[model samples]
Target: MSNPPVCRRCGEPVVASAEQYEVFERMHYVCFHYEFEHQGDPDVECPAGGCPAAGITLPSLLFRTEGLDLAQAGNTVVPAILALEKLGFAVEHHDDGFAATARGSRFVAEDPVALLGLIKLVETRRPWRATDAEIDDALGRYDL
Candidate 1:
C-alpha cells in the first residue's frame, strides 16, 4: 500500500531488486559504501595519473592554462574558460594572466589529494556522494 522508499543518499527510488544498505537509515548500497569508506576524509590519494576532484584541482585548472600557454595565445583559453564558467566556477582573464576568482580560489584551497578521491566518487555518476556542502566542509578542514 505504501510507496517504495527513496534512497536518502541520492534522492532516487530504492527498488526491491537492487542492493540496499542501512546506516542509521536506509540508503543505496553503493552510496553507503562510498560514505562509510571515503567520505569526510581528505588524506586519501588521487588515482594515479588522474586529476584531483574531477580535474577541478587548482593545479589541474592551472595546467589547462599552462598546457596551452593561455597568456601568449589568448584565444585558445576560451574553451577552458568556458568550461569553468559553465560549471559555476569563477574565472577571469586579466592583463597579467588567468586566475580563478575568489570562489575558485576557495575551492582549490582544499587539499588536492583529498579532492581527487571526492572527484572519483562524482565521476561514477553518483551525484549525492559528493555534494557542495560536503565539499565545503572538506575544504574548510584544511584551516585546522
Candidate 2:
C-alpha cells in the first residue's frame, strides 16, 4: 500500500481525525487558521480611505482579529510562524479548508444519516476516553 498523505507544512503523515486543512491544493491543518487570515500579500498596505488596516502586514492583522496584545507577541511572532512551518502550529493559528480525502468528505457532506452516526460515534468515544481504550474502537463498531 502507498504511504498516507503528509501535511505540506509539517511533513507528518495525516493522522485519522487529526484534522487537515487545505490551501492551494495542499494538505495542511495546524496552521490553517493563521494562513487563512493572512492570505493577502504581506507587503501590501491597506488603502488609506479610512481603512483601519492602513499599514499593517496581513499576518499582523490576524493578531488584531483576536483582540490579543500584538505588541507583546510581535517581535517573537516571526520565529513561531517559521516554527509552525518548520515545527508545529503557531499561536492564534487557524485553517482555511479541509484536506481532501474520500472518507473524510463522506463524513462532512450534509448527509443527515451519516452526520448522526458520526455524532454518535463521537459521543461513544468520549466514554472510552475515560476508560483508556482506543478511540478507533468506536469506528470498528460502525464497521467503518
Candidate 3:
C-alpha cells in the first residue's frame, strides 16, 4: 500500500482518513492551529473560537505557574491558582507555589479548544467552590 499523507507543516504522517486529511490540509490539528490560527504574541489571547486565551486578562497564567510568587502576581493570583487546580491544570506545592500538570502542559501546547474550555469554566464559575463533577461537566462540553 501507499504511504499515508504527510502533514505539510510538520512533515509527519497525517494519521487521518482521506476526508480528514483533505479537510485539515494535511496537517495535524495542533499544527494547523499553530500555523494558521495561533499568531502574534503567545501571551496575547488568541481570537480563534476555541483558544483558551480568548478574552482573558491573564493568558500568561497558563504558562508561568511554577515558582509564581503571590506577592508579585497580585491579589488575583490566589483565585487564578485555585481555578487552575480546580480544573486539574495545576497542582499546589504549598510554600513553593504551583506547577502545571502533564495534562495541562499538553493542553497548553496542543489543544487550544481544551484550553479555552478550562479558561471559560474558571471565568464563569467560582473555581474555589466548584465540585469535581462540575469541572468534569465543563470539560466534557469541550469533548476533552
Say which candidate scores most in TM-score: 3
Model 2 lDDT tens row, 1-144: 666666666677766524343442344443342344333543444333323343345453554355655432345544433433332222232253111123233233232233334443553465423343444666667775
State the C-alpha lDDT per candidate.
0.49, 0.41, 0.59
TM-score of each: 0.25, 0.21, 0.33
lDDT tens string, model 1, 30-103? 45545454444333323333322335454544554565632324353455556555656565444644444444
Name model 2 segments beyond 4 Å from true: 17-24, 38-144
1 or 3: which has the higher TM-score?
Answer: 3
lDDT of 2 at 128: 26
Counting clashing residue pairs in each candidate, in order, gives 0, 7, 1
Those runs of model 3 whose alpha carbons end farther than 4 Å from true positions after fitting are: 16-19, 42-45, 52-144
TM match of model 2 to true structure: 0.21
Comparison by lDDT, 2 against 3, better one: 3
lDDT assessment of candidate 1: 0.49
Rank by lDDT (best first): 3, 1, 2
lDDT of 3 by residue, 1-144 (tens): 788888898888876544588676678776777777899875466657656454455545444454765443355555655656676664434343334464535223223333434556555666436589977998988876
Model 2's number of clashes is 7
